[model samples]
Structure formats: C-alpha cells, structure tokens
Target: MISMIMVLNQKGDIMISRQYRDDVGRAAADSFRLQVVAAKETGTEAPVKRIENCSFLYTRHLNMYFVALTRSNVNPALVFEYLFQLIRILKAYLGEDFDENAMRNNMTLIYELMDETMDFGYPQNCAVDVLRLYINLGNVRPQDEPEPSQLTSQITGAIDWRREGIRHKKNEVYIDVLESVNLLLSSNGNVLRNEVTGQVQMNTKLTGMPECKFGLNDKLVIDKEKEDRKPGVEIDDCTFHRCVRLGKFDADRTITFIPPDGEFELMRYRVTDNINLPFRIIPAVQEEQGMTKVSINLKVIANFSDQLYATHVVLKVPVPKNTAKAKIKHSFGRAKYEPEQQAIVWRVKRFAGKAECHINAEVDLMPTVRPKPWSRPPINVEFQVPMFTASGVHVRFLRVYDKSGYHTNRWVRYITKAGNYQIRI
Candidate 1:
C-alpha cells in the first residue's frame, strides 16, 4: 500500500509540472505571434529579423515564460519572483520608444493576468516596492550605445518605490498603478512624479491673496477734475464723500461735484451750526410721474450744542419747460406730502433734546401743458422754502425764501423756455 501511494504522488507532481510548462509555452507562443503580426502590419522587416536572432529569441522566450509563471494558478512564492522578472522586461521595453497604441493594448493583457491571481492576494508592500523599482528604471535617459550595467546601477541607488505599499485600496490602487505605468510608457522616462509635485506647489502659492474689507468708516474722496466728464452731474462716477464716524461729527465738510459734460463745477458742503445738527443729504436719482424723490437721514448727537430744529435740504435739476415739469414729494413715517417744487421742509413736533430722524423727498416731472391748444394753460412753478427759529421766537412761514422765488406762473407757448431750474433750500 505504501509503495502504491508514493507512485501516485510522484505521478501527480510530474503531471502538474507538465501542465505548468505547457501554460508557459502557450503564453510565449501567443505573445510572439502577436508581435509578428504587429510587425507585419507596420511593414517593419527589422522586428522579424530581430525575433529570428538567437539571442533575441532566447530573451523573449524567457521574459514571456516569466510573465506566464507570474499569472500561474499555483506556487505564490514563485509567482512573486516571476512578477519581478516581468517588471524588468517591461522596464527594458519602456526604455525604448514603443508604439503608444500597441503599449495600451498590451497593458490590457497585463491587467487581466494580474486580476486572475488577485484572489491569492499579492504582497501589498512588495507590489509597491516593485512598482517603485520599475519607475526608477523607466526614468533613465538613453544615451548613444546605452550600457545596461550603468542603467541597472542608477536604478538600484534610487529610492524604494514600494514604501507607500499600495496605500489606496481596491479600484484606486488599480487606477494608480495603471496611470503610473501609462505615464512611464508615454514619457519614455519617469517625469510624472516631478510634474505632479510642481503643480501642487503652484496651487498652494496661488491660494494666498488677502481678503478685502469695505469698512464703514472708510471714505472715498473723488478728484473732481479727474472723475467727471459729462455736462450734468455724473452719478456713476460719484465717490463716497465721508465715512460715517460713530462718535464725532463731520461738520462743514465739503464735497466737490463735476458735471458730466465738464462744462460746470460745484462744491457741496454740510454744515451743522447752533441752528442745525449733522444730517445726511441724499440726491435724487430718478423721476416718477411729475416728481423726483430724494432720501435724507438726520441724526442729532447727545453732546451736540444745537437745539433740535427744522431741517432743509437743497437740490438743483435742469428740466426742459416744454417737455418736463417738476414737483416735490416728502414723507415722514406714514405722513406723506407732495408740493410743486424742489425743496423739502421738515418741522420737529417735540424738542426731544436729542433725536434721530429720516425723511424721503421725491421730485417728479410732468408736461406743464398738453399739445392741443384747448388743453394748454398757464402753470405755476412752486419751490419749497424752509425756516427755523428758537422756540420762543415767532417766525413767519415766508420769513425766508429762495432767490429763484416762490412761484413762477408762465403761459405755455411754442417759444417757451426750454428748461426748468430746481433749487433745494
């Protein structure tokens, strides 16, 4: 019984060895056949001659046999050795300029071979280390009559590539390996790692510009001569005159204005004296119906010496008399009023020692008279005039008025004045 068992075991071993030899022979034959076909398609007679050479055939068959062994179903230890040998073969091929399309096709074969043995699980560290070795070998530049000994020495001194040990798992690992191999083949040398390092450094440097802030107290001063170019007020080119300071007040501050056409210039100043307090004066931007609206914000500080009193804001606008008419609209909370003119008058209800107030004034334009003769009529141009006095002092409503006057009643005619003048008091 013992003799029979020994004979069976020996027969089994021999059968396995024969199968392994057959697999290697088949792989080498298939690879050589493909190479011959490719050579014929490209009309390359040299490839056929080289394959026929004794030394070339021997090396080719040995490399293909190793590649076959690496993909075999048994002996994982031998598989690792064969994989390393295959790496060396790839390094040699990649060192020379090979057809990019052909290399891509061959890589698919290699992928399949590697996948088949994945169940046995490759040594994670060995795979990375071997890949690193291949990367170093592929980076060597070819010289006239390149020496294999010199190239091998250079690769040996290079850092171990496998130190990272397939850091990424599953699909990522496969993808990275494929990319590394493609890069090596494409460059005819290893330049991908260096290029990637440079890109990362550049990206880091670009992400460092400082953030900007438009602070509340920051003022933008406009140089009238440099900024304005139009005949009338240039709204778009206007700059912020003063940054609103929280505590102190900016009294008697002036802002220079330039007309759009550059034909006229005006200087505007804010004044808060014993009779008035610091307030914001906003200019009208648009006209609706027959009125133009202007917004105003008035604030009286606690330490301000002036007693809270009535406030007045002035504005100037050119209106074509034949085409446009002007009216004033003012609102204080829910209370609203519209008068026929350009100035707004604010009356304080109670002397609240110190208080803040906001008022909106709108100026609208309308045609003073219709085009038909029957519809035409005389129109009154009224301007708003504001007056303020001490509490005990009795002041008449008409104590102060605009130099342009209260109202101008003019008859509509074809030769009527072409423009209306608005003045804020």
Candidate 2:
C-alpha cells in the first residue's frame, strides 16, 4: 500500500504529486530529494530506501523518478510490481518515447488515471484495456459516455482482463516458445555457468469465452504417469499470467485459463539442467616477442543438428587498449578491427550446423607509458537459431473448448538466442 505517489525530475524537483493518505506529509518528498537524489550517497544502491518512519520505493523511467511513499510495512515485491504496471499503463496511454514534455502536456489525464488505478492507498484495477473503456482524452457528451454501473461491474469482475461480447469471424491462436541461453566458460574449458530461460507467448483472436487447457513436457507431469513415462524437461521454476487458474494447476498440473485477447506471455520458466549449447567457442591468445605483437586464434563449432542453422552470428574478441593496428583473416564470415571498441568484430549471416569456422588476428600493440597488465576481457558471442530450444522444452498438447463450437486454428513455434554468453580467454 502507498500513502503518496510523486513524479520527480532528475534534479529532485517535484513534477507531479498525488496524496492518498495524510499520514505521510510533503516533507517526505524533500527527504528523498535531499538524502537520496541530491546527496547521491553510495552507502546503499537499493531501490527501496528508509528515511525516518516513511519508506520510499521508486523506479526511474526516462528522465523522471516515479516514487511511492508508504508508512506501513508493505510487500516490496508487490510494490515494485505495481510501479512497473504503472509504467506499462502510462506507456499504453502515452507513446513509447514519452518524456517530460509529454507528461507536462497531459497532466489532467495522468491525474485521472492515477486516481482510478489506485484508491485509498491500495491498488485497484490497473488493466489498460479495462480502463480505456471508461477513460479517454477526447471530450464526450453525457449521453455518449458509458454507464457508470457497467464500468464498476467490469472493474470488479472476475475476468477483468477480457471484456464481454468479444467476437471474431475467424478463430485462431498462435504460440511462440522463445528461449535465451546463458553460459560462462572458464579459460581452461570448464563450464562455470550454463542456464536457459524460456517463455510461452500467445496471440489469440477467438470469439466467446473459450477455455483453453495447455500441456507441456514437464518433468513433474511425466513423473506422475504410472506407465509410459517419457523424458521431460527439468524446469527449475515457472511463473504464469494472471488469467491462469492457479488452483487447477496446483491440483492436477493442468494449465487452464481464459486467455486474454491479442498478444500476451502465457508462462515463463527457468532451466539449469540438460541445456544443449548451440555453439562451442575455443580461443587462444599468445604474446609474441615481448608484447610487441599478439596472435589470436578462435574456433567456433556448431553443436546442434546438421539440419539446423543459426543466423546473424557475431563474436567480439577484445584486444589490448594500447593496440595500434591489426590484421585479421577468417575461414568464413567477415572480420574487421574496430579501434573504438578495441576488439575484432566478426559476423556471419548464416551458419549451418555441424560446421566449423576459424578466425586469426595479429594485433600490434603500442607501448603504454604506465605498462599496466592487460585485463583480457571475455569474448562475447551472439546468435539466434530458429526451431530450437536449449532446455528441450516442447508443447505436448493444447485443447480449447467453447460454447460456439466453431473450428479453430493453432500454430506453435520455437526459437533460442544467446544471453550473457561469454568465454574467458
């Protein structure tokens, strides 16, 4: 819960303020401005700060700080979630690049939205779609405005995410399973960190209140089967959308929900076991003739199936900051020395699986006045492979039931990309 919400500029000047309770006074604003922003204290870098009895929880968007003040002991996670949701709602109303000028132009509209989204220090309905039904920037006559009773009902309704009487001529659904692979390899080829995070995104355009039951090849689900149990992905943890019925999922491991219209992420999961890395990078750097020149050799091998391929593969290998010039050659793809980046940047448009590529670079270093040792930063790699999942996660089945009994079309896709993928030299 919050006592007041304030939008302050980068200089700690209050741009907007809304008070829900009188327990927290205007002095709280000055406390944050002086103690947190003006002082720029390095004792604590946390988003939540405590000054006196009031707790200040805040997040920065663009050039403004959206701060929430509270006197009661509030759930930090919930407060942060509400802050982010507020940002999403503002972005929906305003443009993606909304800044100080945009907020100054729409001050009244912003106040109205803040009033409706939160009431008496408690978060109310913050759904953008639901709020858009009643609130608008354009002027409307009394007769043209939606009924107040209906708006109240929608706000308090169980299915606040979806509006009633939603109809579409063609009913169809699309599911995309996207995964990000993160790895940290030691110089001696030891696997330091390897993990995969994935999310299931859905785009649904269906009529009526259709109930959908989704299934996945999860280890927990497969382990419950007394017979014909198959190997499944070992999921460390998962989080679902608000529309999902958590009770049903807890009882039977069934993902049941009346999905929201348009596009939304259905679920996100993390996996640390049995991750299939798509690429193996081997790098060697040797100084030649008393650090006058350095020779760098890098080999990249695709580890996936031969039928698959990665697109827009890139690698960045760092060089000494005192390097003057470099000559590079590669078996495949393009390589060039970037003086500004102090690294050799190599890129390949399309790389086939079961293939290997090599790059060799000879860098000449200018003697530094201080003669400090090179830090030798890690090599970073980036790529995207379609129809692949590092966690081996697969959709088992998706069933839909509706009163209209109309035929529906469904499609599923999978993709995996690199994230924080680094190899030490």
Candidate 3:
C-alpha cells in the first residue's frame, strides 16, 4: 500500500510523480524534496518522515531518490521490497542503459510499466518475464496484443508467472547455487561475525507447465524420510519468489511450484552455522622506527580444496592518511601503493587453495603539522571460488512432472563469492 510514488534526481528535481489516492497531494512531493534531499538527511536517520498525516518512506538509488508515500500505517518492508522490485524490473528492460538518460528516452514505456505494476496502490503481476509477455515495446504487439480481458485473466490467474501455450525446443533446466560469505573480523585475528547468504537461481527451458518439486537438506524432510542426515549447513531463514507455492512448502517443507520461463531467483537463504571459512588472513602493523615509518606484515592462506584455485584475488590494506610513499614486497602477488585511497593494494590473478601468500609494506608518512593518532581500517579480501560453497549447501533433488512427460535433463553449479570479507588490521 503506497499512495504516491515520486522519483527525484540528485538535484532534488522531480523526474516522475504518480498519485494513486487523493489523500496524497502534489505538495507532499515538495515536502520530501525539502526535508530529505535538501536537508541532506539519510534514510537511516529518518526513513519515515510524516508530514500532513502522510508518511514518506524513501530510499536512494544510484542518482535518484525513490520516495513512497502512504496514508495508512502499512508494512514498511512491503513498501521497500516493492520499490526494489520496481527498480529491478526497469533495469531488466533497459539493461546497461538503465540510468537517467535511459529513463528520459523511455518515459512512455516507463509510465505504461508503472500503470501495469501498481493498481490502487497494490502490486499486480509485475514479474519482468510475465510483464514482457504482453507489453510489447517493439510496436509489433506480440501477435496483435491479445484483448485486455485476455491479458487481465492471465494476470489474475494462479500461474501468472508462466503464460499459457508456452513451449521451448529443448527440455532442460539449470540451477545455480551461489553463496556470498560475509565476515567482520576483529583485530588480533578473531572472527567477530560471519554468515553465508545464498541464492538459488533457475533457468528453465522446457515445454508445457511442469510441476516441479525441489528438495533441500532440511531437518524436517530428512527426519520424515529417515534418510541419511549428513552433516551439512542449516538454512536459518529463507524467502521465496511468488511462483513458489507457500501452502505446499508450509505443509511438507517441499518446494512445489511452477517456475518461470527464464532466469528467476527461486529462493534466497541465510546460513549462520557450520560455515566453512575458505581463507585465513593474518595482518600485523607496527611502528618500524618512529611515527613517520611503519612496517606491515600480511599473510593470506587459502584453506579450501588444494586442487581448486581462487580467481581475481584482491586485498586492500589501509594506511595512514598522510602516507607519502609505500615500499611493497610480496610472495606470490603484485603489491602497489594507492595514494588516492591511502592504502596498499595487492592482487593475485590465481590463488591456489591450500597455499599461502604474504605481503610486506613499509609506509612512510608525510610530516603532518598536527600528528593525530591513526585509526586503521580493516583489510578487505575479495575472491571467487568456483565449484565451492562455504555453507556446504547442496541440492538434494529436483523432480519435474508434466502432462507431456517429455524427458528432461538437469544441471547444477556451485560458486562462492566474497561479501565484505575483511580482517581487522
């Protein structure tokens, strides 16, 4: 339930504004521009500011502020999620051109999309794939624009994500299980907080409406089947797309639903327990002789499979703001001084697992008139491990049933990526 939606540029100029209810006025737009943008207040400090009995909840995008106004005390999460979904859909349509210029060029299509997505301040069938079915942008209305009733019927249908009479030449499905592990490390090499956030993305190229059932290594399913309950990670919490049937999942812990045609995020989950950390970073910084010069010793060791290698490994180690120059030495990587960021940047093209690399840097600080104490920042590490998952999450099975019963093949992939993986220096 949103009453009004407004898009403003970085300069607080309204690019677009739409009012769904009479209670929300045009003046609410100026109030938001004045209170949030002009005041330079972040959403963290004041996410929801009420004026004239209307609440304006806003979030900043790349070069715009997406402001949502609601008269009733509706769910804030619902509003924010819808706003994000709106952006994703636009980006899907515009691709790399999803910016201010793109918006200006496609204003007509944008308004049409806004009308299709929201009605009476409630979201309808706004899934990008589903929307692209009828809202043809190419002037050739995708076979003469099926009548309004036909489109509306499909929109209100149970399987709105999939259009009827859909068929693909190949009968195959590919599922990608990708996880990003985030960690906040304390000084002296201690793990302060760590978690794994994962997503299951599916690309289905099949014929007919295939009723699919997905399985995970959940405790309830394992206990009911009396199967081999292997030692794996537990999914703490999960959220699924609308295509996923919530009733069936709630009843049997089974993911039973009709997936969308193209690539769509099926489910997202978080794992906190039993996270296998793949890297260990040790950093030591101390005064070599005086405050002007400091010596730093850093070591990065990969703890995963010895046969595998991490790609695009980057380490950003911070130094004092008055860093004049940095003498860098490394074992298996290239290290350089980044004066703009006041940090020592290191890079390794390929880091073999079960291997270790080291970096040593002597940073000379410029003589500052006022020598203040330095507050060191963490050393952030970034890498991608293919065919690996830090959470140990595996797909148990994917069973598909269709009226056609055409044979099908399934493919699965696993990847682990860095999500704010840092070590306090």
Best-matching candidate per TM-score: 2
RMSD in order of candidates? 36.3, 2.5, 2.4
Instruction: Provide the global lDDT of candidate 2 against the true structure.
Output: 0.89
Q: Which regions in candidate 3 have their CA more than 4 angstroms from the true location?
A: 40-45, 144-150, 223-226, 367-370
Which 10 successive residues of model 1 have the least lDDT summed? 173-182
Candidate 3 lDDT by residue in tens digits, 22-141: 887777778877878888887457678887788988887687888899999899998888888888888888774477877778788888888888998997757887788776566776
What is the C-alpha lDDT profile of model 1 across 48-104, one tens digit per residue? 223222111112322122222222234534444545544444444454333334344
Better of 1 and 3 by lDDT: 3
lDDT of each: 0.25, 0.89, 0.85
Could you estimate the TM-score for every candidate? 0.16, 0.93, 0.91
> In what order do the candidates fall by lDDT, top score first?
2, 3, 1
Residue 386 C-alpha lDDT in model 1: 21
Number of backbone collisions per candidate, in order? 25, 0, 0
